[model samples]
Target: MTPEEKLQHLPDKPGVYLFRDTAGEIIYVGKAVSLKNRVRSYYQSGSRLSPKVRALMNRAADFEYIVTDNEVEALILESNLIKEHRPRYNIYLKDDKSYPYLRVTLGEDFPRVHVTRRVVKDGSRYFGPYTSAGAVHETLDLLRRLFPFRTCKQKLAEGVMSARHRPCLNFHIGRCLAPCSGQVGREEYRAMIREICLFLEGRQDDLVKELTRRMNEAADKLEFERAARLRDQLQAVRQVLENQKVLSTSKEDRDVVALAQNHDLSLVMIFFVRGGKLIGRDQFLVLGAENTPEEVLTAFVKQYYVRADFIPGEILLAEMDPQERPAIEEWLSGIRGARVRLVVPRRGEKKQLVDLAAKNALLALQEVEQEQKSRGQGRDACAELARELGLENIPYRIECFDISNTQGEESVASMVVFEEGRPAPGQYRRFKIRTVSGPNDFASLKEVLTRRFTRAREERELIQTGQLSTRQAKFYQLPNLVIVDGGKGQLSAVRKVMKELGFAHIPAFGLAKEEELLFAEGRSEPIRLPRDSRALHLLQHLRDEAHRFAVTYHRQLRTRRNLKSLLDEIEGIGPVRRRALLKAFPSLEEMARATVEELAAVPGMNRAAALAVYRFLRG
Candidate 1:
């Protein structure tokens, strides 16, 4: 199908769309309130699609879409589809591992309380998609201490089969009601669950009252041990809540998000207030954003909140996007099941929250600016190196390649991009080093960069032909510079390949590992930049980010390799068995720490296998 024909065929209805190459691989995915209108905008003048997309259009042989019942549904479906397909053009959240959430299964007879990541309409109540997994687990731990609701998934699976077996270690540790053992009666467990629900709902006074009543009842009944336990649980919950500061008490749950930008990067800070308590704060660095702070924040709010299941009762912003406010508010109100307000607070507590969020935004931006200042020095050094090597431009967009491996296992090449003066994560690329057999950094880097630039050349042609679409490369076009994270040897290797491929215009450089020196053609001695130079710092940031990205992949590979080796000694262990064990236990160190009984409890590991593991660890 022709690209223009595919664009014409897009439905006018609200939904999500996918763009596919001739080989039927999805290159990009996007959603729209009006699919046809939005899709057509790409061909319009002044669209933000990068030059690379403009070239890739010729290869986009077909298009596909799924029409949703509504825009919100479309938004959710788009997020799921993107996660599943990992389309190359989408702005990924980067961290996709499911984080824990507090789940209270109100419909169950025993009402199990546990940590889960997936939230579905299963007659259970869920509290958060908390940014911090540690914080979520801590809160859940405190809840279990305050009220010993059932933690046994087996009990829920068996439809509340309350066998009076011995209590698990959690019961001994004072974190469970031991409902499985019938130590806590049904009525008592129900009452405890109620108190926990109240506390989670921000009715601390009611929770404390119920706890007091239960403690007194136990004392009067001469159950002094039970009374003392309740007293300790109550104290723990109170202490935790007291430590949480109140951001506002206007009986509203809200979030204030503000963004700030300087030169090439952006900073976004989110202030989370739940039931008037300032739960915590988070900030993110957005690289390669060509939009203003307000513009970025507006898109962020729309994209982020529309995909989230939980909606705040209100959202106070430092900057306003009037065109977007109504749609956002209307969308949020539906999710909240109430009238949700989006306001730009100018005074009082609401305004204070905005100010707080904005302050955080400023601080985050300052950090990025400081980072850019350091990187600018590196960029200048790289530009000087390029000049010494007889290159064209200042090489503002630098791409660094690094290969990581452990003695030939899990060889991978990472490409980290620095645009203007910062590490652009959105443009960072990873290659599994397909051609090289074992631990050949030069070969791996050559193969990765060659493939990258080859595809880039093809994309540039498609774009120039007016065939490619913007969705393919919104912020990722092409790098003006390439820096291999190695010395003159690596630089010589890259130059050889570039000349062979007949691509000569783009400049390239290399940084030596020893003495932290820079290298270029015709420069007999290595060069250095001032510590505070922004351009040089930018190059260093890119190089470090490449190292970091490569090291991270290397570590994951190493961990998986170690996990497999550990499992190999077990009698029944195979690929699936080893994977399950690693997924459940994570590390050899963690597996070593687990008791034989704990190891046996993991799904595939039986008594014999667990014993085998235990003996191996001991040996």
Candidate 2:
């Protein structure tokens, strides 16, 4: 149906609505309590809409929606769809990093605990979304000391554990109970798991009490060894609790949030409080947040809590609209499976906490602004380089290329990007030389340039015709400048390829490593800048980074090839066994030093296979 017709038939219930462009690409996603009235408001001619909405409507050709059971479900589904599609007109969280979590494999016969960055629906209990990896490591270390649980990746089923005759190094070091070898009973392991869960949940008082009770019970039974062990654990828990600062008298879990915005950039700080104590805080930088503080807070609340493992009972915000408070609370309560309150404290300790968070946010914003100013020096350097080279456009986005090879074996090329004078590692790319043969750097460079530009032109056309989304075609856009690693020879090679590909207008240059001189196309002599010039230093940094990236990739390929060759030489070692050996041991040196029993413990490896690999590596 047409846009107007779909609006006419809209349902009057809570749901998520999607606006699609002519190519059927979703450009906007929104949640509404009353879909009929909410969707109709966008089309009413007399009503005023924001400029962003007007722009979205101008490109919107069709619309679709999904009916949810309630407003909470609609809010959840809207967040998921927006994150998945990353619609252009939505307030997207641009950071791509995932926080670490402590995962407990409760489904296994012998459960194991470890740190992971992903959350899957696999019957596991996750304890955290910790912002600092170091903090997670420290916690894991403390847990290992307090509880002797197994840390290996062995499939410790009842049948598998019964077959193991020897324990690993962890057993000798007293760090693991060696469940893989049946050294620990299921009930004993489960008790330890309970204690670990309590510790991670920040219930130190309960954990200490349980440990003390167990210690006394062991003492009553005349089990001195067990009593001593429990006593040590209890002491550790008490010590950690002593270090934590209690912020409130009531044992309530809550989070305080504050935001600071300067122009289009915003910084948000959230302090996590559990058991009435402040545990940790996390800061996020939001770009393109062109809205009121209340609106920004609303968007952040809806988006942030979806990935959180634990939702607090109360969320203290610096500012929020009264109309949106109830809806946000409902959504949070649905996710948490309990009642949640969204509060804007006017006075009290909670208000003081919010103010402290606001101060932190403002300080963080200042640091970001200072960093941007430092980056401005890089931009100025780029402009200076443009003036020196007599180019039309300033080189805000520069791409450098380098090729690495050793006698034509495992040849590879690297592409490094610099945006606004900072290295954009996410945009870096590597290519394995396919068409070139036998150490011909020039031909390898040519092949890489041709493939890169050809794809760029095709993606540009697709974007202009509205056949491809801008998000998908981001890496295909042309750079403002191109730098090659060698002198005049590499510059000429790149220029020929660009001319053949109908991109002659793109400025090209080369930097020679020996003399640190720049070579531009059609220039008779190389240009040399002063030793202290920022423009020359920027070019050198780019060239060195490209070279380093290319060398790293070349070494990885060479090492893998060498490993495969050595494995192929051993008798009775097929592909599966080869893969298992590689997975168990990272390098040839490690494999050579591994014991037969250790090698045999790996999956798909038998005693005979282990002996063969050990003998081959030793020989």
Candidate 3:
């Protein structure tokens, strides 16, 4: 059916609407109370709309809607779609970094405590999207000193009293419970783990009380060593509790949220209050926000809390639409398995907290703007590049590729990207030159470009066919500009690949370091730019970064190959032992520094093999 006819038939129910352009790509996703009225309003002539929405209407050709049972369901579905597709016209929570979390592998017989940046459901418990990696590291270190949980990667047999493994140095140092040795009871180790979890969850008061009781009991029983350990742990927990700021006297869990905006850039700051104590705070940058603060606040809340691990019973917002309050609260409460409230306190301590959050947000927004300015990301580098290249379209996203190898050994390629003239390290990808056999930069470049664009085509096709979400397609987001680190030869290779892949329309360039010249397709004369030009500097930075990344990967592969070869010469070392040694000590230098006893402590290593490894590395 025609788009207009389909719009006319849209049901008058709570649902999510997805608008796609001619290429069958979703450009915008939104939720509506009445699909008929909301979706139809975009088509209404002379209706006032923000420039962002107006731009959306210009490119949106067809749309599809999914009706939900209620507004709460619709709200959830809308948030999921936006996160999945990350449509061009929808506001984005520009949080690219995967915040660190403390994970406990609960499914294992003896759970281990560690820090991780990825959260997956492997029967594990995850806590804290900690603001900084260093902060999480410090917390993990403190926890290890407080509790005795094993951090080793050794696989232990469950409930086996006569296990064959020996306890490591950590066991002797009182840093681990040594579950692998089968001497530490599983329940005992798990009890300590549960205490650590309580501490991480901001239940330090309860933890202190439990530790005090245990210490008193141990002392009465004349267990001097155990009593001392418990006493030390209790004192530590009390110290931590004292250091935490108590934000409220009510002892209730809640979050105070506020936002600050500068033109299109918006920052949302949230303070996490657990047990009426200030546990943590996080800030997010909002992209493509709407004209109103209410809309931005709602979008931020939905986009954030959807992926949140913990939801407080109450959320205090600086501003929100009154009509949106009920649906948001209902959605959160459903996720939390309890009733939740969306509060807008006009007067009281909550109001003061919200104001504090707003001030923080404002400061953070200013800092971000200043950083962008200093990086020249908010300047005219893109326009300058277009003018210099005489291109028809301005490049919003630029991608550069480079090849690295030493004498045909461990050939590798790196692809680096810059969006809005800022380096996007998260999107950078590297490839081990599979097809090329020698130090052939031309062939390697051709292979890398071929793989990159071929995967892009396949991913785009999958997304269009509803087989894959946009975010799942890593290569589908085509860059507006392509760069290769070479002269005319690399540019020709990229051009041929682009033509074959049906992406000939996209602009491609090759940059050579000597004289800093740029080569484009069908141009016999290389384009020369002033050394001080912003566009040239940007391209130079990208090329250098790509080279550095590629060379780094190449060196890593070479190092591994060398290490494997060296270990293969050891008398008692096989593939398993080699891998075990490598896993234990990533560098040969570190391995060489290990004592025979230290080497024997590694999993699957016997004393004879450990002595052999120690002698071989030394020799």
Candidate 4:
């Protein structure tokens, strides 16, 4: 549908809108207080969106919306839709795990403590969407120690309704109240629940005082065991509360925000607090962002906290956003249970929190900037390389192929990937030089290039269909240029493979080691780089890395054979034990003197066998 037709159909009510691409895939999702006005704004006069937005709109096939009762409902619906579809243009919370909450399911006659990733609007009380699993585990531990909440997954799943046959380890350790076996009455369990709720709601001091009073009463009644147990729990709770005093003292809800920017990236840190206690913190680092403090500050807030698990009473920012602040505050207030405020403190304790968060973000951005700066020099040198080879563009990510072996014995092919002129070690690949019997560089080059280009062709199709094959995709993407460590014949060999793979468009060239010269496809004479040119240096670096990678693989094969030969000399060790030892450790150097206990852990090597191997190696 055209923009005008869609705008006319939109309702002036709060809702979520979807932008579909030419292939009918949802490319973007957004929430608006008034669907008609917001959707139409894209086509209104004098209103220009970003270049990215314009590109998205140009490809947009149609739009769709779901009207809601209120802005709050729209906000909630938008979050759900974004999660379900994972629209490309949406600022996504990428983790597959749901935002967690501490759930106290009291609907049952017997209450249970559980950690849940989702927050449902059920009658049960929920505490948090804690960002860290470690924090959640620690909180559960504290609760179990204080209130005798069940910690066993099996017991909880089984719903210990009647009681357990025997009090488990938790009861003996005083971590559980042991009501599951009917040791504690319902009235007593209810009282413990009240105290737990109080403690969770930031009334720890009062709860402690009341518990101490109850303990004294129990002692007066000559209930020594009950009083003793209460005493232990009270001390534990006090210690936990004391340890949490370092971060804050107010016990009020607030979020600390900070921003950092580099030449092409930015980072934001958001610290969430509830009841004046630190709950969790999230850090967001954005790529391809420019170095403007105000723009970075604005983008960080809008992009990072749009789907915040918990909205605070106040948002504390390191820098102010004058224009976007009003819109953000309005949007946030609708989602939060109560009024939400946005502040940029000039000088105070709150400001200090923002400052610390900002400093951390700045350090992170500085590290990224340094890395990018280092890569910039490499990329510039590669640009010179493209010019030297008379190619279309800079070889930012170049792939080089080489063959290795001793006269075709254990022959292998190696492909090394370089990104922005630096070796991407993880992307280095090895092939067994299939379809070639003898030590023919020509045949080896054709086989390796065909395999590489064929996979590249298939993956490009997959990417277009929004189904990337794997982490290996970047290596398979047609490089800006290709390099081989040989003369004109090797270059032609790769060119023929590219033709067979239907990818003749990819430029293939070779750098012969003897003359230190480059030869491209269809060229008889070689092209050489200027002795002092940075481009020449970059090309040489790539050639050297590819050569090193190929030679290293050959050396490793030789080393493994040597190690196997040594193992064969030892009578007790066979192929099974040899494989086990090698698999268990990184290298022979580390496994050279492994202890009996360590050696026994390797499969097929028991204590006797392990000792025998150890003694043999030691001797």
Q: Which of the numbered candidates is closest to the native, going by highest TM-score?
A: 2
Order of all candidates by TM-score, from best down to worst? 2, 3, 4, 1
List of clashing residue pairs for candidate 2: none
How much is 112 displaced in model 4, in angstroms? 24
lDDT of 4 by residue, 260-285 (tens): 76554566767766556664565656
TM-score of each: 0.50, 0.65, 0.64, 0.57
Local error of candidate 2 at 365, Å? Answer: 3.4
lDDT tens digits, residue span 1-619, model 1: 6768877777779888888887899877777788888778666553466554554454566677889887767766775676688765444433434645678898776787778878789998877656567777887877666676667686442335356465665665566767776677777778888887777665676677889899999999999998998898789777877898888767567778777767656677887777688766656555432455555666566555654546677777777667556656776687778988878877997888888888888887787678767777656665764564456676667788988887988898888877655567878888777788987767777888788877777777777887886458432267677788888878877877777776656667788766667777557777676566655656666788898999898898788787788678677787776876787777788888878777776666677887888888878
By lDDT, the candidates rank as 3, 2, 4, 1
What would the per-residue lDDT of candidate 3 be over residues 421-492, giving only the tens digit for each residue?
888888999999998887999999999999999999999999999999986778999999999999998899
RMSD of 4: 10.9
The residue ranges of model 4 lying beyond 4 angstroms of the native Cα positions read 1-71, 77-255, 261-266, 271-315, 319-345, 366-384, 392-397, 404-411, 419-422, 433-447, 450-476, 496-505
Of 1 and 3, the candidate ahead on lDDT is 3
How does candidate 2 score on lDDT? 0.85
Model 4 CA lDDT for position 390: 77
- Model 3 clash pairs are none
Better of 1 and 2 by lDDT: 2
User: lDDT per prediction?
Assistant: 0.72, 0.85, 0.86, 0.73
State the weakest 10-residue window (summed lDDT) of model 3: 156-165
